[model samples]
Target: MALSPQDLHRIAQSRGWRDGRVEVFDTASGKVTVKGLRATRHAARYHLLNGVARLLGLPFLQAAPMPGGRQAQQTEVARLRALHGVGARVPEVLHVDEDHFVMRWLGQDHLGDVIQSHHPQAAALWREAGDALVRLHAAGQYLSQGFARNMIVDGAPAAPAWPG
Candidate 1:
């Protein structure tokens, strides 16, 4: 089910990205996450660092925004849609507005959590996650931030759809 902005605000936690807000809300259907980029002082720091890097002929900080002012929400949606169309297990996008977007929450657990569990199912989970990554890459989907925590594991035999 698609979540409204009001629903997202209701379940918002105090914690979120340094330059944005991320809230996970639970509903009768499942969890949904609302991610939005917020104006923050951190942007200045990033820009400064990027400028210094350019002057020094060094690589820009990974945390710095991409060149040409890429819009995070739109980029993410495009990537998700591409991945999904190629049969990559990925969360279905419910809504989008400028800097904000909502997507179905895969689950509480991610590959990071499962790998640390040491449970018997950990191996299977890892295999599934790996397979999903392979599929995504094979489809030419290159995730700039490829972290295990970004891949969700819902304890189902099949891999849970991924959430960014």
Candidate 2:
């Protein structure tokens, strides 16, 4: 069944999310992350950042802030599809509405958590993340935010199969 923004908000509230824009919940199909694009609290921060970048003559450093509402929802849906089409490890979009969309939950842990926890495979994971970024760039696709906190790390590390 398709989920609407109201349904998602109800679920999020039940899960202890007061006013978050994103919420992760489980369904019969599987776990999913629902994002509501109706908040613009960070718009001013992006505007300031972009203004600074423009003044510095660094157009490439400027990014479009989340437009909020329907436009933001559509843009996010399109970007997710485009990125997934080019073999990027983005979440698969499951459902979309006028102001909200649901995607398959990739994982709960971010790359930043792995680094902070000093995971044994942190270095290898970091290298893999770099390789993924290079691959994405080679495909002519870029992320608005590519920080470690935004990169989700799924599953446990596998032992190398190389023969010594």
Candidate 3:
């Protein structure tokens, strides 16, 4: 059916980013992403479970919930997590669960809009974006997939990363 923040918190072990019906709280706040398989029942859960396990300092799937199912994906997610902060420009990993994560919500703007927009500041934004990319690479982390449809605008900054 659908996944909820509470569900994710139940089985999640760390923090991360999400793809299915997610809500970006502010400049840096992710709740469900920190939770994993229990976080939701969507395609991303499979990858999230794999990619963010190590990012959130949680054990890989083999050492976690399902044991040996999809070890390869798990490895990749671990890579992403290990590279969580290569430079000082990486998104702050908020938390991670079985297959979910939460992170600092970078401004909810996509590359295309940032580049193709008619805004006068688009040019400057483009330059900043270049720097952002370098900084991200320096963080030593690599996202297997994240573009366009990956972002969501949730207005100005809000509450803490997650309620305790």
User: For this target, which candidate reaches the highest lDDT against the unseen true structure?
Assistant: 2
lDDT of 2 by residue, 1-164 (tens): 45556656555455333257788787766788877667544578888999999999998999766676677778778999999888788998878755567898888778987777777878898999999898899989988688889999888443242122
Worst 10 residues of 1 by lDDT: 155-164
lDDT of 1 by residue, 1-164 (tens): 55655665554433543244777766655777777765433476677787887788886443546432226566778888777777777888877665566788777777776676555577887887778777777867777566788887776443343221
Q: Tell me the spans in candidate 3 whose CA falls farther than 4 Å from its real position.
A: 1-21, 25-84, 134-164
TM-score to true structure, per model: 0.65, 0.73, 0.41
| Top candidate (TM-score) | 2
- Candidate 3 residue 157 C-alpha distance from true site, Å: 13
For every model in order, what is the number of clashing pairs? 0, 0, 29
Supply the global lDDT for candidate 1: 0.66
Off by over 4 Å in 2: 1-18, 40-63, 157-164
Shift of residue 111 alpha carbon in model 1, Å: 1.1
